[model samples]
Target chain A: MKPDSPFLDLETAPRVAVSIDGAPLELPEGANLAAALLAAGVTVFRHTPVSGAPRGPFCMMGACFDCLVDIDGFTRQACMIEVSQGLRIIRPRDLGADDVDA
Target chain B: MSTHDLIVIGAGPAGMATASKAADLGLTVAVLDEQPRAGGQVYRDVDRVAALRGDILGADYTQGATLTAGLHHQAIEHVPGATVWAIEDGFRVSYTRAGRGAQIAADRILLATGALERPMPLPGWTLPGVMTAGAGQILLKQSGVLAKSAALVGCGPLLYLIAAQMVRAGTPPVAMIETQTRSDLIEAARHVGGALRGWPYMLKGLKMLAEITRAKVPRYPGATEIRIEGTDTAEAVSFVHRGRAHRIACRTVFLHHGVVPNTQAARSLGVSHRWHAGQSCFAPRLDVWGQSDVTGVFIAGDGAGIGGAKAAELAGRLAALKVAEESGRLSTDERDRQAAPLRSAHARELAARPFLDRAYPPFAGALAPEDATVICRCEEVTAGDIRGHARLGCLGPNQAKAFSRAGMGPCQGRYCGLTVTSLLAAANGTSHDETGYYRIRPPLKPVTLGELATLEHSAPDTAE
Candidate 1:
């Protein structure tokens, strides 16, 4: 994977450990989950259910729900969620299969 | 429910201004915002981000510091991270803060929810690396990060603004693919005289353009037929420029047409809205003082229309002044005297808007993307799916949504509402206004049933 993110230096900000798909990674604490994941060279946040197309954060604000991922059993927008220690994040294989009734 | 003189939803420039001004006029005000901090999207985390990277983010962002500071007035109560789920009749607001549900009643309600980037659906727009230009700017503002090399696509002031900011942060884009044609520039020239009244804004845009040009960034103007080519993520962008086909290799592609008023909250409250052909979106109808047709309900800022921040601040203050006067807190004479100067300033600030709107109208092709292009990111609905549903007797956006599930995802229609409406209009052979938009219902945002069940007044009322 290419290093797309410019903020790779973790010394300027506080660092915390997080798991993406069960793989441990260190990200800046208080940074948005999408940014942290992108910085770690993790794109393709989730795959769509309809066509199995890959998607990532589009709006960055909460408006675009393309960055939805499983956080602790409940799906949440990665752009809206913040990074914290020992946070377990899972990228869904298929969004349609993981649909939970609201 | 605890009742107050006023309840302001959103803590952006408009909401902050309204709350502070209303509090100053002796009205008890409570401000609720979803973000952990005030300043909305434009001024997100201003206090901290400005202090850390003031030079990088620029003065336009640091200016938000003043509004965020004003929100700290002693007379005003601010609630951060509160998601307002519903607004009932009699100005009752239901919200959840930190997973706990609560309700508040107010004599007046002001919605300053702000604007959203216009949806620009295109080929491969759903790919991982394709995101909005505003999203790139938000990353820079909130986390001081940028992509190593990317192609900045689309048009409008925000495209240039983000490109220049990226250059300042030492991560200039590999290329800029601007979609505005020579004719658009000629169209904009007619309004130069009126736009000159807002010279500072014009100069700011010029400075950004100059900066990008000086950096020697490759810019392709009048580009068309843009297609992002990548299977899993955006690897390259191909477009036609100067009657020639060109492809730029890059990992990221930022798309932005312009911004539209975020009208979901207001619409859900049953406030009447009309299609704003100038900006090409639906805006809630409001009086000069920002009051809606619903009594005691007011709307301010870009949520009403794309008036920018300065205009939003003035409009916010004017709405608060009207609220104060209507509640008997201020004399009509005092209200008039205070609002006169702000009105003039607001007009001056908005003078260039007509030119900007005409110069960079929502990219026409973006509204009606190709058949295979995804229009709704949440449901993965394609433009073909929507048009197919329209042919099956879908009358408007709401009907199309029910048939295709384009606007039924967690986003609820924020991203796809405008595009769906336009697609329906085209398919039905009607104007966007006649095609209409989604019929919004609460909880406006996705709220858990557990959260609603925990409301302070969840028990049924036998008295009723």
Candidate 2:
């Protein structure tokens, strides 16, 4: 399925490649990470540790931290971060299983 | 810690205005914001949005360009991407920027943190495709993205505004389900005379409604019993309109009722707030000069109350003028002279608030969702669980939080505070204020222990 993106064609804008949970993706440089992820059909950002219910980005702004993810080794708000090249993003569950040294 | 003359939190309309006005008056000002840009929420990404997609955003957005330009004065220091963790007595602020911890003390502090969309907890709101209307607008503003099709639900001028903007962007929703009833119109009619004093706002709202109608978008007014249904994500919205049940097939559902002041920073600083009856939310109490009960602390803009961007700008200027007078930079007569026009402008800007408040007060029923609806997204606590706790004599939000872990999550009650307060009040048969809000403590936003360990203590006199 093609991702839903309303962004007008900005051909000159640079594109960057990144990996989300080991799945390779390409997004416009400087785009909000959460928006890019959503446009790539990645809906479920994480599941709650307690109830294990699925949740995704509710407030694209930083007020709701539903878009928490593991960027590199640190957990961060995906809505607040900008897309960058070669970024290794992992879901919360995957981050939990990986060694701290990863 | 380093000391400065003034420190402003948030870079939205209120904060940028305060910093610019104070700096222009010869007071050194520093602005700290979590976003990389200075244009707060309403005007988020104004520079880039204006440059890239100016027409689709309309004139209201372009107005932000002037404010963002004003932030460039030499006397105003802008510290973007700084997350303030705590505000101590003596106007001391500790924050983390780029993973480094630092502290700054100010002779005076101004908090203009702005507003958040009022929580509209409904059945199936926890589903994946259910999101706030404000969040959808932000996505369009920041990234030029829109869902293939969605249903817009809720009441307020913002709902109409976003729908009209979407129509202009050529991605109008499949339908708009507005919750305001006929009685709301009658109540608003009582305030029309007062609202007419702010003629521009009334006209702007009319224009938006006209545009939405002209676009031929299906609208369901007097909507109730609204529920979004889907197996794993929102697939459709079912609601009752004009005594008939209607279901619209759509993948996305956007919800909004209105906005409330973001009082976490003020509440954490021991600042006092009173329940604002007109807006149906708690706001920090302030004096004529915007000074709170705490000495050297002032709050202006929507964070103090839900004044729009224009009023926020004027309020910020007025507060800066008061700061100047207090600091002996301007005599009382000069200060009054400087403030005379701004006070009038501020009054003009606020004249339409009473009408809007009455016309689209949040649907009381929407505050308390169904038994199975999730109240806290982070902890997955349901409204049923909270009501049960309230039955067990949970008196207030803090006690309720202890029982259900509703407010004890990363977002820290930003999304669920208002809803939880309403649920407790209803269970106890009391007013919202009587139940009180969550007792917010610092670090305000999450900061890692590793970040705190990297603090570089500054000399006693310098400002960092």
Candidate 3:
């Protein structure tokens, strides 16, 4: 992570190991997944299927779907997820990330 | 199915207060919310955040702890981390938790779904580095994450509060690009008398501005032609201020132009909605008691209209009292006596809204952006496309949505519904009311098929 990234790490909680886009990183436990990713210098959360454009956590609430990511093969809002051990997150794209959903 | 005397759809100030108030009135209450805690967005994760960084979030946010404390009432079931997806006739509620679905029944339903930031669609707003100011507040509250030196753009008191919050966190914003102009000020002055009745709120805003001033953050008022400029990500914010064009180099940009009622859950209920021209959005047509056209269904808080947090709490109390009386738990006279003070307090809390509405109306072009600006983030539909659909004989937002798939994303038009309505309104030369919003359907949140399969279907509640 950049020492002076635009986000400050105010979390003093113990860190846990989580994989992002297949890379391992230590993030504060129980932190919001989206905020943790951003603080860890992972801004681009997913690529839009329509235009293939990079998108991040815009609303940080569930209203904006820009923070969608694949956690254990299910597309979910990173902002809605809490950081935990062994959360495998990947930014799925192109073929429509949520096609598996009803 | 779990049954209740009343089911509250959100755990915001309104929902939380309603649950406790109704429980006090001897009505069994259930408060379901998507957050992990009781403090909706305004006070999300209030207990822990209060201990971790209460000083950074300020007293206004930490005060939510008191509201959350009431969730512990035995008569009130605080079902946190549950996203409500369906509200059927006869008070049948459907929701998802941990990718599993469940159904519950209630005699009464109160939607306190609250507000969402109005989408500030401009060139390159879809870039990875741009976010709403509300998102910044959420990060700080939920996870103690603070944006560092980001430019706070657009308008409203929220921008000031966020700038102040960041200042206190020791990572003051790089600048504030305000969109309110002289005309907005003149328009706001007409309502200043009533706004002064809300002096405490106005004072809070002033203090926030003072904090920003103390931090020496650069302020650009009356900014026009605002745009986020970059290729892969937001690199800088460019705008015209005082007739001189300037570009500020910044890696991140936080945008705001006030908030609108998050009407998705309300609209899904098929309730009547009216266009609010001042706020430039649609609000559910609700009675003074916060009851919607659908009998026994109520909407309080920002979901009914954008009346901030305190007003929502009052609305919740008033609505709960009405429900309690109608349920035969309280006498009509007693209900009125209980609601009288709440009604007055609600009025006082909302006194400044008209001024705030005019002073920081949805920024021009937000409703009708340039042809290239993407209005629908999910479908990547642009304003020009919606207008093109209008030219292609699309009559309203629904038709435009059907023609261009503008509101088909997982968000279900939460972000772009108003913009599509406005673009079509202008294109068809009709009133915004005529150019209605998308017809929001069931499963308000994206529910997987496997999740829906978990729902144990039950007949709608027959108890009136």
Candidate 4:
């Protein structure tokens, strides 16, 4: 871990490599996916399907949908997911197959 | 189908307490929570993160261990990682759990879905690095994460608590840009005597402020015209403080304007809710026993209203006591006897609410921000668009939903319902109650089609 890591007393766990937006990064296994992504300097979680504006996890408690990311072909809340090995994540251009912005 | 005498949704303070108490009264209970752990947001992952979070988050968080521990009773089945999407007429709850779907039957239902942090819908809030105070707290609680030198903006008691927690974590915020004006404080003075009766709550706030002050964190009180100035990401926070334009150079901005009941599940249950002007949210209309207008349904904790965790615990137990009586295990007289102390204690906790609500009222600007600020995080609907809908005769939330798709996002208006209501009310020259809230439908949480196919019987009762 970097000495200037954003986490406090971030204990060493079995780190697993995950591909976020086609970039390989290591995250602490079983940690929050959203927080892990943020710690790894991946800030923009997704782009709004409407305007394509960049957005990240805002509520982290699953209330806001800002952290919606495609996890290995499925869309889910990153905040609600625990980090596991080899999870492929991406920001979906379309919120769903049939998408409309309010 | 798994059947229980009672089905409780959420594993927060309210749900856990209700399940444990009802089970002890000999009614089989099951608690379905979305998280893998039992502790709701307040005590989230307390068991795993205890050593890292206890000292920083303080005893209030550590206390969640006791509440979660109560879920261990044999009569109480705690189902963690369950996302309940629909509740049918026969007290049937359909939820997605562990990559599959399941249905449970119960004679009684309790919802303790807790509360959502009021969305701080200011300009650039949708930008990267701008998140809620609760969100930052969750990162710290769940994973010992902290964004360095972040600035917290908005008005609320939780902001101070979060700031103090960050200070204790050795990552104190760079500044606090509070939006509560002097007049707001003066307006709250009338409730001083009432709030003083709840001195412990008041004292805790003062102590937190002292902690932040000791750390020498710069605070801008009564700030106005606040804006997050960034093109693609949150680079800095600019606001008018003390009648002068000021900008704080910071990478991360945590915005909060207090909390409101997470009413999505309860509203989806088809219960009638009344608009609360003080909190500026809609709370379910429940009787003294926490029974909603719907006969077999009950609400407790913040889902019932915005009582803090302690009060939520007491209210949960009170609701459980009534449920116990209705389930035929306990008598009405016994229920009343047991509820006596809890009721008084619960009343004491809420006594401090009026002053706090008025003093640190939701930032007027953030609640109805500039035309450009995004109100609906999921749909990216701006305030100006919602106001325009009102100008085009969008009289209520449901109408605004049709006109602008303001509440149709997957999160389903949980973040934008209040703002949409407020904007329509303001534009149409009506009160919030008159403007009304979105008539929430089922599938409260998004359920995947893969999960839905696993259901053995009919389709979801929700209208497409």
> Which DockQ values do the candidates obtain, in the order shown?
0.57, 0.51, 0.81, 0.63
Query: Model 2: residues >4 Å from true position, as ranges?
Result: A1-12, A94-102, B459-464
* Candidate 3 displacement at residue A101 in angstroms: 19
lDDT of 1: 0.87
- lDDT (Cα, 0-100) at B446 in candidate 4: 88
Per-residue lDDT of model 2, residues B1-464, tens digit only:
66778999999998999999999898988899999887998899898788776787889987898999999999888999899999887788889998899888788999999999898888888777788998888888888777768789999998998898888888888999998888998989999987899889899899999998999999997898888898667889999888899999987788999999999999998899888989989999899779999888999899989989999999999999989888888899999999999999898999999999999989765787888888888777889999999999998999999999999998899989988998999999989879999999998999998998887656454335
In order of appearance, the predictions have TM-scores of: 0.96, 0.96, 0.97, 0.96
Alpha carbon lDDT at B128, candidate 4:
86
lDDT of 2: 0.86
Instruction: At residue B455, give the lDDT of candidate 4.
Output: 74
Query: Chain A TM-score for each candidate, in the given order?
Result: 0.82, 0.79, 0.86, 0.80
Give the top-scoring candidate (lDDT).
Answer: 3
Between candidates 1 and 4, the one scoring higher on DockQ is 4
Q: Can you write out model 4's per-residue Cα lDDT over A1-102, one digit (the tens) per residue? A: 343433444546789998877878888999889898888777777777687788888899877778889898888999989999999998766445354533
Proportion of true contacts reproduced by candidate 2: 0.51
Interface C-alpha root-mean-square deviation, candidates in order: 2.3, 2.9, 0.9, 1.8
Q: Give the TM-score of candidate 4.
A: 0.96
Q: Model 4 chain B — which ten-residue stretch has the worst lDDT?
A: B455-464
Candidate closest to the true structure, highest TM-score? 3
Candidate 1: stretches off by over 4 Å = A1-11, A95-102, B458-464
Give a tens-digit lDDT track for model 3, residues A11-69.
Answer: 88899998877888888898889999899888787788876788998998898889999
